[model samples]
Target: MKKTARIAAVGVIATLALTACGSREDDGDKKGSSSNSDSTSSSAPTDASSPTEAAEQYPDFKACMVSDSGGFDDKSFNQTSHDGLVNAVDKYGMQTAEVESNDPSQFKDNIQAMVDQGCNSITTVGFLLADDTLASAKKHKDIDYSIVDFAYFDDKGNNTAPANLKGLTFNTAQPSFLAGYLAAAKTKSGVVGTFGGLNIPTVTIFMDGFVQGVDYYNEENGTDVQVLGWDRDKKDGSFTNDFESTTKGQNVAEELITQGADIIFPVAGPAGLGGLQAAKDNGAWGIWVDTDGCVSAAEYCDILLTSVMKGMDVAVEQGIADAAGGTFSNEPYSGTLDNGGVALAPYGPNADIDSDLSAKIDDLKQQIIDGTITVETP
Candidate 1:
C-alpha cells in the first residue's frame, strides 16, 4: 500500500528540529513484538497450494526487519523494504516483527532484539546497519539475514560474509543516468544539481550517474548543460552529512538554485523532502530517489519530474520467501535495468518533454539493458 503520511507545511521546521535532535519516539523499544497478523483469506486448494494453504505451510516461520534512522515513514528505501516484509507475511501467513532505529547507536540492539525474538529470517534496511547485521548473522548461524544497499565484499571483491547472510544491492546508476538525461532535456536554465545525505557509495552512486548522464547529453546535443553539485572526476560534492534533517536539505538546494540550477535531485531519504519543498518554492523541477515520489510522497507530485526507483520491496519479499521455504542462500542479489530491478518513473503531469525526447530515453534504457551502454559508478 502507498504511504499516506504528509509533512504539514506549518510543521516543516519543527519536524526538522526534532529529527536533528533525535527526539523522535523509539519504536524499536517494542522489541520481539509482532506488529502484524495473518490477513489473507482464500478458498481451499485443488491441486496447487492456495494462499491459505501457503500460510499453513509456514505457520511456525517468522520474518522480521530493522529500519535505519529514516524509519519506515521516510517514504524511501526503508518504507519500501518494510513493504516487502509485509507482503511476505500476507503470502505465507507467517508472523512478523520490525524495529525502527532512530540513531546509529540503536543498530546493534535493534538487530539483536530480532535475534532474541526467535526470528527465522531478518532483513536490515540501509548501508549503515551492515556491520551489526554481519555480526549478528555470524553469531546466529541458523538465522537467515539480509541487508539492503550493502554487500559483504571488501575492496578486493572477495566474499567476506557468513553463509547465512545475503546482500540486496541495486545498480541505481542505470536509471539515475536516465534521470540526468531527462533533466538536461527539460532544463530551461541549462543547469541541474544533485546532493546526497552522506558521501557513502550508496549515495554517491546516484550523483555519479546523474552527472555522467548530463555529460552524455551535452556530447549528443552539443548543449553545455552544467551540473551544479557533484563533480564525477574528483568524487567530491554537496552532502548533508546526515539523512534526517530537511532544513539542511533545503539550505543546500537553495544554494544550488542560487547558482542557476533549474532542476534538483536529492538522494537523502526523508531529508530529500526538504529539497523538494525548496524546488516547489523556487519553481524548479525535482527528481526523487528510491521510491516513486508521486506515489510515496504525493504531496510533491506537482513539482516532481520523475523518480529513480529501486525494487527493494520485491527483493526483500523474495529473500523472506526463500527462508520460509528452506531455500535460503547467501548469494547476493544485484538489481539492474536488465532485470527490471531499477527503473525511471513515468514523467509527472507537469513534465513537458516531447515525443522525441521520450523515445530517446526509451532507447537509452534498452541500450543499458543490452550492454550497449554501461553506467559506471565512480
Candidate 2:
C-alpha cells in the first residue's frame, strides 16, 4: 500500500512501545482473549476442493496479529489489516488474537507473545517492524510470519525474500494515477496538488503515478492543466515527515492554493486532515488516501473529491488464509486495479464530472490494466 510517512512511523512507534512495556494492556487485564471463530456464518465457500476451502486445511492453526503505533481502529492501515485477519478466522476455523502498541520497543515482544500463545502464524503490520520481524523470525524458526508494507532481511541471505515469511504490497501507482486524472478534470483553476508524509518509494509511487496521470490528461485532451505540490520527474514533493502534525499539511495545502491549485490530494494519514481543512478554507476540494478521507476526516467531508484506495483489507485476508492452509510463500503479493484490490473511490459531488472525461479516464484505466498503457513507478 502507498503509506504516508506519518502512518509508517506510527507502526514503528507501536512496535517500540510493545517491546519496552511489560504488557500492552494493564495489570490483570484479561480482555485479550479470542472473540469469535464461527466458520459456518462467514462468506467463505463451503466446497472442500474450492480455492477458499483450502484455508480449512489448518483448522487447528491459530492466527495472530500486531498493530503498529496506530490502534486497530486508526481508520486507516490498522483497521484494514485487522478486518482481513477477522475474515481469515471465520473462514478457516482458526482462533484469532491481536496486540496494539503505540510505542516502538514493543514489536519483538508482540511477535513472541503471539508465538507463546500457540499461534501458528503471526502477522506484523507496517514497515516499522522490519528489524523486529527479522529478529523474531530467526529466534523462532518454527513460527510462520508475515509482515505487511515491510520486508524482512538477513545479513548474508537475500533480503528480498526469506523462507517462512511473506511480504504483501500493492501496485499503488494505478489508483493514484486515476486520482490525478480526476483532480485535473475537476480543477477549476487548471491546477491540482498533492503531498505526503515522507519521500520513500512507497510514497513516491503515488506521486509518480499522479504526475503521469496529469501528463496523460494533457496529452490526450490537449489541455494544459498544471500539477502543484510535488514534481515526480524532478523528484521534488511536499512532505510533513510526521503524520500527526496537521499544521504541516495545512501549510503545504495553503502554498499550493496560493499557487492556483484548486484541487489537492493529500496522502498523509491523520495529517491529511490539515489539508482537508485548508481545502475548505481555500474553497477547493481534496482527494484522500488509504481510507475514505471524507468519512475519516468528517469535519471536512463536503470538500473531499474522492480517495485513492488500496485494498489492504482483502490482501491481508488472503495472506492469513494462505498461512492457515500451509500454502504461504515468501513471494510478495501485489494488489493491482484489475484485482479489485486497489482503485479510485467513486466520485462524490463531482460525480457529474464531464461524461466524456470520465469515459476517457475509464478507457485509460482499462488500457493500463490490459497492459496497453504503462504507469511507471519510481
Candidate 3:
C-alpha cells in the first residue's frame, strides 16, 4: 500500500531560523513504555513483509531518524522518511527517536545526538546528508545506517558499500521520463519546464529524465514540444542552489513561463512552493516531485498536474526493519519502477488527464519497467 502522512517546510527567512535553531522532537522519550503505534495506516508496502513481521524477527531494536534542512515537515521526501520511521516504531513497537535539522550544518550534530541516545540504527534523510552519514557509519560500524536519495561513491570510485550502511536510492529517471511525456502531451502552450534546488545529482536526475521524457513525447508524436530549464545533453540549467527560497522558485517559474512553458516542475522541496505560487499567478500548470503535490502542497492543487514520486518512506522503513531483523545487507536499496519504488502521481481531480494520454503513459511506464525503455542519468 502507498504510505501517506504529510508534513513540510517553506520560505526564505525561515531558512535563517532553521540554520540557527534545529527542531528537536524526542518522539522516543518513553519508547519502551506502552504508546499508541496505531496512527500508521497507508498503502501496502512494496515488500511482501510488513514492519510487524520484520519486527518479529528481531529481539530488541531502536530506530532513529535525522532529517535534512527541510525538517520532517518539508512535506516531501523528508516527511516521507519520517513517516517510515514512525511506521517502524508503531509496527514493531520499537524504541524510537527523531532529530530534525534546519540547515545542512546541523546534520552531523543531529545524527550524533541520535547515536548518543543509543539508537542502533540511524536513517538519514536526503542526499545532502550522505557524507555525514557515511562518516558516521564508518566511525561506528556497529550501528546500522540508512540514507535516502543517496548512494556512496568513495574517493577511489569503487562500487562497494560499507559493512553497516544501506544507501537508499531510486531510479527516478524512469518514472520521471513518464512525467515528462505526460507534461509534453498535456501542455497547451506546447512547452514545459523543470528546475532544481541545487545542481546536485539527486535534483538534476529528475531534470534529466524530464527532458528525456519530453524528447520521447516529441519523437512519438512527431510534434515539437520544447522543454526549458534543462538540456539533457549539455546537462545544464537554472538552479537556485538552495532548498529554502520560494522567491527563487517563483523567479525560476516566471522565467520558464516567460519562455513559453505552461507546465513547470520545481524539484526544490519547500522552496518549490514559490514556483507553485508563480504558477497560480501566471495561470499555468505544475508537476510536483518527491510526493503527491496535491496533498503535500495542497494549496496549489489546482495547478499541480502530477508528481514524480520516489518512495523513500518505504525504502527507509524496510532498511530499518531489515537491520532490526538481523537481515540487513550492505547492498544498497534501489527504488525502481519494477519494485514500486518510484512512479508518477495521479493527475488530481483539478488537473486534466485524458483517457488516451493516460493509457499511453501507463504503457510507457510498463515498457520502462520491462526493459524496453532505459532512462540514463549523469
For candidate 2, the clash count comes to 15
Per-residue lDDT of 1-378 in model 2, one digit per residue for the tens? Answer: 322212111110111000110111221221111122222221111221112343565566777787776556555566567666766665666666566655557667666766777777788887778778877777777778888776544676455656778877777798788778877777788999888877766667788888888888788789999987788668878898866568998998899899998988887666677888898998999877765544444455567666776666677777787776768888777778787666765555433466676677678778888999888984
Per-candidate TM-scores read: 0.86, 0.77, 0.83
Candidates ranked, most accurate by lDDT first: 1, 3, 2
Model 2: CA > 4 A from native: 1-60, 103-105, 151-159, 294-300
TM-score of 1: 0.86
For model 3, residues 126-244, the per-residue Cα lDDT tens digits are 88898899899989989999999888766885646688998899988887898899888889999887888888889989998998899999998899999889887777898877787
* TM-score of decoy 2: 0.77
Backbone clashes in model 3, listed as residue pairs: 1-43, 1-44, 1-45, 2-43, 7-73, 7-75, 8-73, 8-74, 8-75, 9-74
Alpha-carbon deviation at 18 in model 2, angstroms: 32
Computed on alpha carbons, the lDDT of every model, listed in order, comes to: 0.79, 0.67, 0.74
lDDT of 2 at 315: 73
User: Which 10 residues in a row give candidate 1 its minimum summed lDDT?
Assistant: 10-19
1-378: candidate 1 lDDT, tens digit per residue: 322222111000000000100111332322221122221222211111123334455767888888888766677767777777766776787776666677888788778877877889999999999999999999999999999999888799887888899999999999999999999999999999999999999999999899888989999999999998798888889999988899999999999999999899999998998999999999999999987676677778778888888888889989999998989898899988888788887776577667788889989988888999898994
